[model samples]
Target: MSSAHALMLQGAARSARLLEETQAQWRASGDDLLLFAYGSLIWRPDFEVEQALPARVQGYHRVLRMRSRVNRGSPEAPGLVLALVSGGSCRGLVYRVARHDAEAVLTALWAREMPTGVYDPKWLVCDTPHGPVRALGFTLSRRSANWCGALSDSELLHIFQHARGRYGTTLDYLLRTVDGLRAHGIRDRELERQARLAAAHGLCTPTI
Candidate 1:
């Protein structure tokens, strides 16, 4: 093949190799775990989960803890990150897997939730009926104009209560959360109260 054709062929080969490696990683991880969804993932079930239930995790509060990196991912990109709002506690659901499926499960979740370094990963303790579940979480990286420290309770709820994105709006996410919780036969008072406060405070206003 010519030099130009050779280079192009090499690049394609490398891309295919990377994809194979990624799939291998997923298969190796097996199943039986999941990262909680305190934010947008609650609404968007892009990643396939064995099962999801309303459960609490500890040491992190659900803060509007992310910088909105629109250019990186959205309808335009693919992945999305609602950074961990630091400095508080977050309560959300614990998605269960098959114990040997962490690799594939996480990769899928990352594709849907965190496509790139627009947001980084963090380890948090999850409060579950079984016990504290350690899982990976997606949060805003320190690389964006929208990067802001964890927003206060009022701020978080306000954003979700009235935020919108390319795929949908903030209100849409909140509405989904309400529905998801109800489906689990649970009512998240904290989230519900935050939604109320967000409405009262007005979500359209600047939260960060």
Candidate 2:
């Protein structure tokens, strides 16, 4: 592993501590906790949720702008993942965890998402089919060390083609995320375009 990877992994303990602090704050509220899912969380929340409903978050759009150096790639060849960057709106899911299980659910969630502390977890308003609900969302900072911002089609294709990490290849992560969105009746045109381009270039197999 590269020194960059080692440096990123060093934040794991810090991330866990921050998550615990956040959990404590939530516990003090005595209310059901809601989590917003826009990417992998939609398909692989891994937490026991009481309800999952179609929801929308405004002022932020889903884009493949976050760099993954562990779960989906390496230091030399990082992979891309979706992040809620400022602008537009995103259609996704809002998961509600029971007040009783919130602590355990949050613990597991942090273990999965806060490995490198690249995302800023914040409370955002979600427009659900039922009604508007405030939910905890993991938002990306353009200033964050892990932010990849925008990349050209060729760059994305190269990473998707060659990058792999402990979980799987970058292509696998993208395909699964797109599939997950489709399963929820949401279609992301940008992601679709990239996936098609990658397949045409024989970089990655088309799964959409």
Candidate 3:
């Protein structure tokens, strides 16, 4: 096989193994499975959820600082996606999955989010209106190859204009995320600022 194709297969195998390990760990813990959603998961959770509550996770905040090579952008002209980086706090939704359905739900989640094992999945304490719940959250390390760190306005504008993947454009993803957060009465000023930047440049119509 070609070298690039072989690397892709290797990444896929690693992702599968990681998913299996995570599932085994969760099963052994004997606790309810909770998923923390901060981005597209907030709008599109393709699994059956027992309950979804507005949750805030401390010590990590959301930022559109990851490169999407398959879902939201191409490899050549990569687009940005959200990830939970260290420091600050994040406001999003936490989904509770019934014990009976956790396995199936997690399998589907792995396929969607861990296609190449780009994220580090961790069990985090999410504070909800009711109480604190331990939830599975995806975080990205700054050292990861997919980490975008920080981008200037020109870089973002270029991605907004050119990047497109199997799912859709990066601009659409950002707009949708901002809309989802707004619907939950969660105000993320930084995300809103990016949306405004896009609108100001006439890249997309304002939705927030």
Candidate 4:
């Protein structure tokens, strides 16, 4: 066997293990499960949602600081994605899944968000319009290799202009997210600013 083929097999095996572990962990969490959507999940849950409401989670902020090497770009040229990082607060949507469907919903979520195991999924307290509740969310780990930290406006625009993957372009992801937030009367200045930068470069259409 060739060295390149062996490495490919190793990578596939690693991804399979990650998926299995994520499914097991989520299953053990409990029957009642809530998921917080702070990014693409807001617009595209792609899962069965029994109930969804506007919610705010403290001690975290939504920022485009993670690399999406598959959804929005390839391994050679990764695109950026949002993840909840420590500090501040974030307003988004909290979705409650039916107890019977918890396993399936979480399994799909893990498969979509944990392809690289870069996010740490946890249940956090969220203040919703109805009331406060505990919800599951994916947060970024500073220790993860995919963490992009902060980037300049120029860097952001460049990535938005060129990055594309199986899902779509990175710019499409950003614009759609801001649009989703707007529908909920949520204004994310940071994301809006990045969209404007991309629009100024003719990479993305202005949605704000």
TM-score of each: 0.56, 0.91, 0.95, 0.87
- Which scores greater on lDDT, model 1 or model 3? 3
Model 3 worst lDDT window (10 residues): 3-12
Q: Which candidate is the best by lDDT?
A: 3
lDDT of 3 by residue, 57-97 (tens): 99999999999988889879888888999999999999989
Model 3, runs deviating above 4 Å: 1-3
Q: What lDDT is obtained when candidate 3 is compared to the true structure?
A: 0.90
Ranking by TM-score: 3, 2, 4, 1
Tens-digit per-residue lDDT, 1-208, candidate 1: 7974664466446444544554554355564556677765665666567777556654445543344433222333222234564455556676666656666665565445443234445556776777776665654434554466545765565445444455565555555566665666656565566556655766533221
Which regions in candidate 1 have their CA more than 4 angstroms from the true location? 1-31, 69-82, 99-104, 140-145, 149-164, 182-194, 197-208
> Which model, 1 or 3, shows the larger TM-score?
3
* Ranked candidates (lDDT, high to low): 3, 2, 4, 1
Candidate 4: where is the Cα deviation over 4 Å?
1-30
Report, for every candidate in turn, its global Cα lDDT versus the true structure: 0.54, 0.85, 0.90, 0.83
Tell me how many clashing residue pairs each candidate has.
24, 0, 0, 0
